[model samples]
Target: MAVPQFQHLAGRVWVCPGDPDPEAVQAGVAVVADERGSVLIDAGQSPTHAREIQAALTAAGLPQPRWLVYTHHHWDHVWGACAWPGVEIVGHETAVPLLRTEAARPWSHHYLDEQVRANPRLGPSFRARARAMDSWADFAVLPPTRTFADVDELPVGVGLRHVGGGHAPDSTIVLVPDSGVMLLGDCYYPPPAHLRRPDDGLDLVLVRRLLQDDYLWYVSSHAEPMTAEQARSAVETT
Candidate 1:
């Protein structure tokens, strides 16, 4: 798959890199900004990437996000969420369990620790920030004061609909009804749907069920912008 790059699509939507890995747990991040403010969809893997997202938001002239939507509770997506202090942290109700407990598990914490391993020169800095800035449940996860299950519409200044969840059990997408744009939270894979097994993360089968047609463009939390046609094609294959 091609490396994802930030692109401004029509209707106040944007996608940008959330980390140096750009794969697996630390894939990337997506942003939905509008006149009202911005909503960060699925924060990156760690505190460093989270901070990076804040910087990007500033560059875009968007107000600090009023909401931070986590596609699911995976470490890569919500771990750095603490970086966005005041925004509401939204996610599938099922996802909260992992957010509250997963970080404490030896494997979960260890795996996250492994993700920080990086290029020789970048290793030191990545290591320092990764362990120092573990996910702050109190500040990040608590704010989601608003939540829904299976389906929900988050109004990010502009409307952002949380669509299908083919990645994780709690995964979903952020849809823009007007521009036909959607921000997929780990919906597909590095690109989408076909990159992994049907049962890998979320039920790709169940997630694909929501779309009866391909009328929406998309911005994946890990991938790049895909047109309605592209999305429909992937849906067909799935």
Candidate 2:
């Protein structure tokens, strides 16, 4: 339904669009940008979403992404990463082992067909977009050009830490300390706030141990932004 959309947060963090069910309120991409460039939390469902993310990066005075972090190995989150150039993909160590080298899996193969079978409630060009995700030309993802087993924190400019794992086994969260914000790739969505289906929440015990108080802004790849308190609270509920 109209390509996709992006939502801004505190004027720095942002979320882009994806192959979300048109009626769902929670679909799309979640992006984290700082002075260095932009780091998309999730690349989104299809390759077509690259333009939407590129526009956001441009508006923020950045170039094509220098880095990207996938929340997990799900096709919706990692498959479209090929759209951004010169990016050093980063994710958990196990991530690579889980994804397919080919996009011919039953789940992905059929899911695209589902879109085609359902036809244009998605406004104009929905079928064309669906075909793109199915075609290899649209995306050639690399789950994580760089990986971390336990933890790997890098300088994302503005004194921040891009943390990895602890969520679906490959989740990553980027934290900006001075601003008290943590750009969670996919580790922090509440049990059922997803723009798509139910993924429940993540490992509260391990996740709790991983978090530091310096984090204040907790932005999920699925839901809107949150606070440290909100992060703690949500974890407790889980």
How does each model score on lDDT? 0.59, 0.58
Q: Write the per-residue lDDT of candidate 2 for residues 1-238, one digit (tens) a residue.
A: 5645566665455656444453332235655566666566666555555656667656656445567776666555665677777778777777787764534444344554676467634322334434545465545656577877765665665222334433455555555555566665555433322222455446566568756777666665555566778878877886
TM-score for candidate 2, residues paired by index:
0.67
Q: Using alpha carbons, what is the TM-score of model 1?
A: 0.69
lDDT of 1: 0.59
Top candidate when judged by lDDT against the true structure:
1
lDDT per residue as tens, model 1, 35-131: 5767777776666666776776677766677778776665567667767777787776776665667645443345445654533443443454455
Alpha-carbon deviation at 158 in model 1, angstroms = 5.9
Candidate 2 Cα lDDT to native: 0.58
The count of backbone overlaps in candidate 1 is 7
TM-score of each: 0.69, 0.67
